[model samples]
Target: MINKIDKLKDPLVQEARELSSSKKRIFKNKIQLRGLEQLMWAKYAGLKIESIFISEDQNVDDYSGFSSPTYQTSNGILKKITETNYLIPCVGVAEATPNNDDFDDFVLLLDDVKDHGNIGTIIRTGKAYGINDFITTNDDFDPYIPKTIDASRGTAFKVNFKRYKTPQSAVAFLKEKGYQIVATSPYGKSLQSTVELDKKPIALVIGNESVGVCNEVLEAADHIVQIPMHTGVESLNVGVATGISIYELRLKEVLTMLAEKIISSLGRKVSVTSKLIRRAFDIKLKEISEFSGDQIIFLMVLKRKSQMNEEQIGEQFGYFGDRLEKFISPLYENKLIKKEYEEIEITNAGEDLLAKLWPIHEKTENILLEGLTAEERKNLKSYLEKIQQNCIKIMKYEV
Candidate 1:
């Protein structure tokens, strides 16, 4: 952001640049905490503290029992240090790195997810669900985005993340080290059947919201499962879906892990169905955002009606899926059209959710296929595939 040469006081980035080197051990540990809110939040959030910065005008007496090196800087000096044109009286810098787990149990893989809020929410969910140690693509959003940072409730500081230039590299690292890679796809096998939950040590890769996972990334995954839908809603918001998926997957993994342990150590498989159900409820929250699946169905139908119908919608259920009820109940509850209904309409909510459904559905079907059950999903699949083939043909034809 401070790209202009003149805008920078130490335009060379000498401090950050110098700190970039592993030497300067003392300086690396010397984190300067500035601003009242930063200090308060950092303190409350249990982040490590080395020192604090305060402006002369602020009420010093407000903070009790907190003492550190206090430096008096001119308004210009404070502005110069953080290297921002916009001035803030305070900020916090902590010389702390969050602990990274190896994720011997379960972890979340970020494949070039470049949105700041999305990354932060992903991290927050990872932490919430007892997942740590991210193996993410090099181009993924910075975990330290101010919006991400705030959205994460400071949990970002507590997460351990390593970046890889390609998702393949990360997958290789995890696989060679022995971890199952689960990729999420709307068109993939149903979640319930695809994942046994009884499997131990898995990594779930959440891709870009718009394009989903790249083909290379998808090929790298061990299994793919979709968040099943009823009516016509195609996908869930990346953050919301990521939270639900991680929560469901990890908890199930944990229980299955414990079951495996009990089976091994105690020579018995312990049943935790009740506990699993409760955990699933708490995590797979009903945040549909749309009024009904029909709302979503109406949109997808409006988008691809010539290609799909209700019979195809039924086949998706025949596929093993998770959280399908969460998405479908409302549509069924409201009796909205699912590509088969005659009267069709798209509400404001439907339009909004539809914008997030990217890379289209037929592409989804061809990418992840099972034998066509009743010809409805098949018809939709065929329609979509033909359209895509025609588009490719035309593009090549144009050339």
Candidate 2:
């Protein structure tokens, strides 16, 4: 339900106004959200709304249905509550989003970044590039402060932040957790993009606006990198530099991650090898025939079976319905197969096409098994067949 508060003296209004003070916010354990976007984002992040105060001119219908109470008040009161010259349409009082210790593969370390706006912008940029965990040296820094929230465009709600007593302590903790510390500095010899990265987790240290990364953290870092700049230009803004660094460094991490997954994951290896084989077959078949590798396989299946009903053909190649019809229609039009009722049989033309395509298949297989001896090839086939049977059994059990 919506209620009317005509005076600034109302208890709810006074409480919300008090939240403008940092000490009061902590004492009350609530944060004052200034605009509708902040309120929407806070709700989206599952923050509990203690109350909402909307300007008297705003449509009450727009503010209704929230589980928390909403009050309509004059613009002057809203201006007073938010401490801004211009009126904000809505103000929200919500429980401060709690911080968690959980860290991801990519994290941002803010070293003595005193400006709330910079912190907010870094968080916004970091979140955009898939870095959600932010570490800071300031124990009392509030991520939900109105200016920071405004700077972040409410993305602060989605960010997870943790505080450390000092940058050294934070580096120690991350190092213990197996994170590779990469600190940014203007004096560094290596460019940000050139830093070598592995598959281990990364903690990128963005330092103070005036001073770069601290000496302690720099000494501990696995790589000290900088963004190249023109000779006259001294440095980029902390937020801008952090954005650039995060993007470039994250890309390197992603490449390292992909390489590691390709090397270590059996499923990934099989999928990649299958794709390469298909691609090679497709290229080789194009030189010898008009049919695609899959289409030729379909023709070969018919030749092996002698004849198959439509349903049985679909089952053999995992194609059905319109897809199966689409696959068969072209071959039928070309007179490569004969259809009687629901049954299909390969024609002389289909047999002739397969004969021409068979050598390309043999050549592709030979290229794939170039280094393998005869005995090794036989054992490899046996192993693959066993793996395929195991997969089939697992699928059957699950079904």
Candidate 3:
């Protein structure tokens, strides 16, 4: 329900205005979000909204879906609550950004970086490169400040961050977790692009605007790297430099992952490719059905053979014992499949499910083989069949 508030003296309005102070925000465990875009992004990140205050002229429908109490107020009250002279469609009070301890393969470390704008920009850039985890020195730093959130374009909630009392402590933690610490310094002998980065996790540290990386972090880093610049230019902004470094490092990581996937042994390559194909199929299958790719594949096998015993099915799919039972239970419970004595068969419902799912299978295959010619695809299938037969023969010999 939307309430009408005309006075700045209202308790909720005063509370909203008080959230502008960092100290009060921390004490109340709430953060102020200004404008529609920020509120939308906050909701997308699953942040809980306590209340919303909007100008009387703004549509109440836009704020309705938040499931929070919204109040329609005068334009002056809206400006006062958000501390902005310009017109803001709405202002939201949301739960403080939650901490995320799950670190990705790459982490960005902020060492005494005081500029909220730069921190936010780094976060935006890091998100672009699939780096969502960050570590920073815990002092007076607040990543959710209004300027930081604005600079991040509302991505501050999408990322995860952890804080350490000092940069040295953060570096030590990363090292203990088997991460290779790469710190940026203009004086470093190694160029950013040329630095050796393998498949190991990395912690890339960006430092303060005025002084660069702290001495302790620089000395502790596994690799001190620098971005090359024109002779007259000393350095770039910390945010810009971070963007360039993240791009180069992420590109290298992708190339490395792809190279390993393709250039490994034949068996490994086949295994990885099979996993990738299943992952792609699962993503597409989710849009149309609740079943997983493997479950659908099981249904397809039953359709092909009409019926098969447990032993026969095991031979084809390599599932047995509890694993087999766990896989089959869902289908049987859902009435998609039925059992007759020792034989298993697909029900009419299963057939219908397959009819709906076959197009997704074909589409996923086409997407995977997008650039390959028909002849190449045929040859590829033939090669895989031969490899499968050889593997079966070896398994039979071992048995």
Best prediction by TM-score: 2
| Pairs clashing within candidate 3 | none
What is the per-residue lDDT of model 1 for residues 80-151, given as tens digits with 9 covering 90 to 100? 655557665654455546434455467788887877888888888888877767778773335654566667
Worst 10 residues of 3 by lDDT: 253-262
Q: What TM-score goes with each of the models? A: 0.55, 0.66, 0.64
After superposition, the stretches of candidate 2 with alpha carbons farther than 4 Å from their true spots are 6-11, 24-29, 74-80, 83-89, 263-399
True-vs-predicted CA distance for residue 149, candidate 3, Å? 1.9
Which pairs, if any, clash in model 1?
Answer: 34-91, 35-90, 35-91, 190-320, 232-297, 293-331, 312-376, 312-377
How many backbone clashes does every candidate have?
A: 8, 0, 0
- Candidate 3: segments with Cα more than 4 A from true spot: 6-11, 26-29, 83-89, 255-399
Residue clash pairs of candidate 2: none
Range of the 10 consecutive residues with the lowest summed lDDT in candidate 1? 1-10
lDDT of 3 by residue, 113-213 (tens): 88889988998989988888889876456777888998998888888778788887888888888888888898887988888776678888988999999
Measure candidate 3: CA RMSD: 16.0
Q: What stretches of model 1 exceed 4 Å from their correct place?
A: 1-35, 44-47, 63-67, 98-101, 139-141, 192-194, 263-399
Error of 2 at 72 (Å): 2.2
